[model samples]
Target: MPHKRRVYFISDRTGLTVEALGSSLITQFDIVEFQRITLPFIDTVDKAREALAEVNQAHIDTGQRPLVFSSIVDDAVRAEINKANGLVLDVFERFIVPLESELGQKSLHLLGKSHSAGNVKDYNHRIEAINYTLSHDDGVTHRALDEADIILVGVSRSGKTPTCLYMAMQFGIKAANYPLIPEDLEANRIPPSLLPHKAKVWGLSITPDRLHQIRKERRPDSTYAALDNCRYEVAAAEKLMRQTGIPFLDSTTKSIEEIATHMLHEAHLVRRVY
Candidate 1:
């Protein structure tokens, strides 16, 4: 068994960047098991001291030095955190000096610049996109198809709703999703309402076994969840998408992030939020 180590992601803001970077790097070393903790909004010297105490305590408890990944921009706060009984990896200190040398200028050393609170316009755009996606879910309305950045067409539970919401919340993309119902599958044609916006339509397909497993959880012992029915619907949906020349992706193997990103890339949709 691999020895477990305590890990800390410390930042002056939400600590999202530190957590993401640390988690990604830690995953490369499969031999070590990591216990992760995030200390966000550690901008002040007092907060930094508190974080240091926690890190030290973890190291004492585990008898191993806790790995600290810090994105704290403040010099005083970063200095205090460095007093902890662990290896402190300061992201800004490590990169900013080199960047300053290359650019022949010093960095602003600002806090919360990456995901700042002052960006009201971008925040509002994300909220609007999320609202639009919620209201337009499952072909509930074709009234505003023209306003959608992209339209996702898929059979039920083929991972449409979550992908649309993720795109809206994360990228400020007005995503709309519609289900390919039994009638549509049987007809082997795209819905008439989607015909005008066919150019923006993307299809999501999944393996029958996976779809069957998902459906069974919602409607146990029903024909809707049967493996044979799932196979038929998927095949019909794929054929319809091919005949109409619409781009499609399999959702069985892709995460929600991957699905949303792939659709954005394929559809050439501009992200309003960074």
Candidate 2:
């Protein structure tokens, strides 16, 4: 059996950065199985002490010291967690000290500064992008389609909706997605409404086996979920996209984030939010 270990992401606020860092690092060691646990908002000495206890308890239970990735800003609170019976990696202590020396200045020790909510413009832009994406989903309406940074076209369950929403949420992109029904595939052409905005149009195609599996979950024992129908639809959709000069990606092996980021890069869409 692979070595089993516990990993903790400790932070002063949302713990997103800490989790991202720790998760990325642990992925390098595929031979071991890591059980991740996040303990966020550790801003006080009491909270830090509680966190330390949890880490210690994990060590006792697993007979292995947990890996702690922390970004606590409060010195007193950090001191409490420093006694954890694990390999504690301090995020701020590692980078901020070197950065301060290089710049010859003291760094801000404020809590949750990285995820500060003071940027009103960014918040507003994110909201607008989400709203726009929701309204334009599944070709609900063509209104303001010209404002979209990128548009994804694919057959049903080909992974269009989630990719568009991810782009809008993560990058503040006004993304819109449309589904290619049987009629469009039969005609062997792109949707008429999308032609006017072909410059920003992209496509997503999925493997027939994967598409069949996905559709079967949503609709069982139906033509839509049949392997033969899935194969036909995917082939026809790819053919239509190729004939219309639209670039597409095989979404079978890609995650939502990968699909969204790929579209953003290929389309050269400006990220409206940081």
State which candidate has the highest TM-score. 2
Stretches of candidate 2 off by over 4 Å are 1-3, 272-274
Give the C-alpha lDDT of model 2.
0.91
Instruction: Please write out the lDDT profile of model 2 over residues 1-274, one tens digit for every residue.
Output: 5447999999998899899999999999998899999999999999999999999999998889999999988889989888999999989888889999999999888875553378888888888999999999999998898899889999999898999888888888998989999999999988899999999889999999999999999899999999999999999999999999999999999989788888888888776545
| lDDT agreement of model 1 with the native | 0.91
Q: Superposing all C-alpha atoms, what RMSD in Å does each candidate have to the true structure? A: 1.6, 1.6
Q: Which residue pairs does candidate 2 place in steric collision?
A: none
TM-score per candidate? 0.95, 0.96
Cα distance off (Å), candidate 1, residue 235: 1.1
Residue pairs clashing, model 1:
none
Off by over 4 Å in 1: 1-3
Residues 109-174, candidate 1: write the lDDT tens digits.
Answer: 887677435788877887899999999999999888999989999999999999999999889989
- The lDDT for every candidate, in the order shown, is 0.91, 0.91
